[model samples]
Target: MTGLLPELSPGLVLAGAVTAAAASLWLLLPRSGESRAARWLGLALGAAALAGLVATGRRLGGLGEEAVFLTVALVAVISGAATIVTRSPVYSAIWFALSLTGVSGVLLVLGAQFLGVATIVVYAGAILVMFLFVLMLAQPSGLAPYDRVSNEPLLSAVAGAVLLGLLSLAIGRLTSDTACCAVAPRAAGPATQAAAPAPSAVDPLAADQVARLGGELFGRHLLAVEVAGVLLLVALIGAIAAVARGEAALEDDRRLAAGGGRR
Candidate 1:
């Protein structure tokens, strides 16, 4: 128990700090009656705290890798926090879009170029546009009541802290284990089988990543692909129905006003 204390202390501290920072930001977020300065202060403090948390992790990688990681990470963190704290629903949605862009950038850094581009095209382009259209059509006048105030801020902060703590512990343990495995010397052993030849980059079968991806998606995950298509179609139909309903309501109001004036 005494030896275990040393290992647990850092994680406990990180969890505590994250929880405090998250709670503070949540408490200070702009409610309908809150002042602007408090919101701004909270945003700044939250950003600083997040930066500190990332710095403490001290992720091991090349200089270029580290730079790219920090750049996209900061963008994702700051914009994500802003999305939650912003007063205007439209601005919040825009911030959320920026956060998604940062996530796509991270994916690119991690060597998933196809997935990154797909994320941008599908999420940032198509899905975000649909979201904005729905938001506009739903609340043409101004912010809705739900948007004006956050529900269960304390509970949300606690939940976020727990997730962050778990993520940090997982990353720390994985990195430490990787470092240990990398540095530890391997024992001499007899060869079991002949090694396979490495594939060449210029090889036709190996080069076309898109073709490989398509084969995997259609071959292995065809049901998931079909389900996704069905979901998109359902969402499109729902959006159309919602817009039609709003227009019908407006037309009815206009007709009633005209009838009252005539009477």
Candidate 2:
């Protein structure tokens, strides 16, 4: 079917460029400045997203079946890779954000604005901010201990490869080799009256596309959404517990000073 082929527009080019640039800057910064591994991973993922945007633009004339397939492949590869290759808690967090953003861009290209916005808002904005906050607060002691994590680099590599394989399979299956299903005859009428609608002003909440998203998550993917909420709750509790423990330890020292006759 041909109906799924998306119209290519100059706007796609601009969006691609902007996204690519943002991701590149995020990835390229030095660790001395902001964790090297994280920066490179973020940069690599950003590059991948840009590549997807470019591929999407090229396919804009209509991502014929083959183009759609290739586009999805690029996305799966990049996002999966980003998830695995990033080290450093903060860097991993940023790469995770990049992957989420990349998925959103792919959805946008496919005309799924609602899904795209949800991915970006939930994953990139809220979830990521939570993670970054945790990492910053932890200020992990001892670079030597952190460096020892590399001992499991092989395990990380294997896990990443498996993730990539699964993502590739999932995307490949979702896309058809044939162009999107064709538009029905009656649906093609009223070409003249089909003027393009004017764009609206940007709204922060509008970017979340909340209504469409609320319905989908609560209606179709109810179980998945609930599970995610539970996971988030667990993470929040754990974080609070950790901070409390650190503060309690500090308080013990203050009491020791006050009661121990400090000069």
Which lDDT tens digits does candidate 1 get at residues 1-263? 12333554666656655865676567666565777677667667676566447645564357887888888978987798778777788898899989988998988776666787899899889988988998887875766677778777767777877788788788778866855534322221223111323211112233466677788799999999999999989998998999999999999999999999999
Q: After superposing candidate 2, which stretches have Cα over 4 Å from the reference?
A: 1-76, 141-144, 159-263
Clashes of 2: 7
Lowest-lDDT window of 10 residues in candidate 1?
A: 192-201
Model 1, position 220, has a per-residue lDDT of: 92
Which ranges of candidate 1 are over 4 A from the true structure?
1-9, 140-146, 178-208, 230-263
* Structural similarity to truth (TM-score) of each candidate: 0.70, 0.42
Cα lDDT tens digits, model 2, 1-263, are: 22232564434443444455444534442223356576667667567545544443323344474476466646654665555444455666676777676677667655577777878888788878977887788767644345324434434444544564455445544554334322223323356225423121112234446576687679999999989999989998998999999999999999998989865
Candidate 1 clashing pairs, residues 3+ apart or interchain: none
Candidate RMSDs in Å, in order, are 7.0, 11.8
